[model samples]
Target: MFTSREGVTLDSIAAPLRRWLLNPVLTVPAALVLSGFATATPNTDSIKFLVPVCALVLAGVLLSLNDYLDKQFANNWVSDNTWNWDEEIVVVTGGSVGIGASICDQLLARNSRTRIVVIDYAPLGWQPKQEETRLSYYQCDLSDSNALRSTCERIRSEVGHPTVLFNNAGLVRGVSIMDGSYGDIEATVRTNLIAPMLLAKEFLPEMVKRDHGHILHTGSLSCVTPPALIADYAATKAGLLALHKALQLELKNIHNAPRVRLTIGIFSFIRTALISGHTNVPNFLLPLLHVDTVGEAMVSAVYSGYGSTIYLPGFNRVASTLRGGPEWFFRILREATANFRINFRGRHEVDSQTGKILKA
Candidate 1:
């Protein structure tokens, strides 16, 4: 006896109701309901509080199920062979070292025909054996607008438009807000946020026209929980995450361009050249993950062909959920963590001309 309008009404109300049922607020009630079926149990008072918690947990499981379904739908009809390993051309920014370099190495090893173009100001100590042929290098400073534009032009002409664009160039000036110069803030924002936007704007047209492409952005955990000392860096990353989300929605829902995939990686510490100079953080909570692990995770995300946000180490998802708590709570927790220490020993200054770290 259900009319079309009644069915529509039920559908409209279902999502919110489902969400409310999952919230921690209803955990106690849910626990109590389950207790009725049990013959013997612990104190009744405890059972009352436990019910809601169990309900909330169930809600979370259901939500995760929904997300999985959505992701499966997005990747539907795409075979593993759709990746085109033979023709996969990946372009990684700031690829001279760290996680970027690791990614490049993995990609090259997977397919001999896969060409990798690395854009960086300085060179890493080790180079791919096939640099002149399969691997190409471009020395360009991402912060400079003209340099970026020129580099993009050169890349298009030399290597053809990139099938996979990794917007990974970033900087972290350890100086506190009062101690940091305007140049420091400008350089960080320009390189981390602006350059990615410009690169996407310049290259995305070609990708759209081709009807196939992947854009992977390196977002930070700091974007979700901004630290006091690294405000500028955090702000830039937050902007990058926002940009990635907006672009994903535009390409998927509005444009209906299913072939192009956008992914944002949110991660904590990874062992990389960028942090080589810094003292090791405590392994208990904020342990450093291997650069290879991060690289593999990023590449896997790209191949998934679904618009999604990835959090490394699994626990990052829990931390991100707590980011909505009171500001004082976050501040207190951050101060107590090992991340607050100022122990970076690497060269903080870079050569003005080359953008390479200047020797102390």
Candidate 2:
């Protein structure tokens, strides 16, 4: 019953439902009902357990309804011009590896005439072999305003003012706030949060003048639910979510730049250098997303030309709602989930220069 094209759509239905059923508000009520029934019957453990099962089933139905609505809107209302890569200049930050690299590869493959500009300090191990003339690389630290300004100027000259900008660069110092240094925290904020705002400021005006462009911001699961160890990363991601929302509103409502599409990607853990070591989590609960899948989702969002808050592996929309729960309950759930860790030694080693994990 599943088609390759509809796989992501189906995933969207399943992912949110799983996360919704995990909410304490829903679970607690079910638990209370089960407890009351058990007390009355004295041997109703099986009956009590049905509460969670029923809640999960209900959540699934609701998620399917949402997916149906989304598909209807996407098919009918969304613009398709954003997918015309041939007429667009594509600029991607942190396109050297992982999700960014995958996006670049897919973009290049889509249109040989598309001028693709990759901004990263170093090369990703796997570069696009096709369309060599169409693709160019710029080496600069996006966090530095001076460097970014210079890079933007150079790109403008070489590739023309970019029509599609992907603020996909991100960093994570996989340590607790107590153990992480100030530099580590600052680096995470600078790269993840500040850079996107600055890039938008620099390129958005040109897009508005041209009256056509697409901007995609790569957000994280941490934006919706803050994890324990990566406090700084979480804060930056949350800021990104807010920034994207505000920008979208400003462009659509105030500026009347409806043609300027702003897309936010709310994705979970993917099999990348960033999470190379962590593998203990349940695959059903938190499956490691494929790099290609991440790229395809971004492409689909951009092509659809409808501004969206996309959550990969589907369940992330549920996580966003559960974020409103009491802090104590949320903290307990986060701590329980934090037990996953990667076996760094057993995984492919990442190169210091390129940041690409060597395929074993």
- TM per model? 0.74, 0.75
Model 2 residue runs over 4 Å out of place are: 1-83, 131-133, 326-328, 342-360
Global lDDT for candidate 1? 0.71
Note the clash tally of each candidate.
8, 6
Q: After superposition, how far is residue 32 of candidate 1 from its true place, in Å?
A: 26
Question: Per-residue lDDT for 140 in model 1?
Answer: 82
lDDT of each: 0.71, 0.72
The local lDDT score (0 to 100) that residue 208 gets in candidate 1 is 73
Q: Please, what are the lDDT tens digits per residue for candidate 1 over residues 12-78?
A: 3444665666644465455656565332656546566555567577777777777778676544334
What would the TM-score be for candidate 1 when compared with the true structure? Answer: 0.74
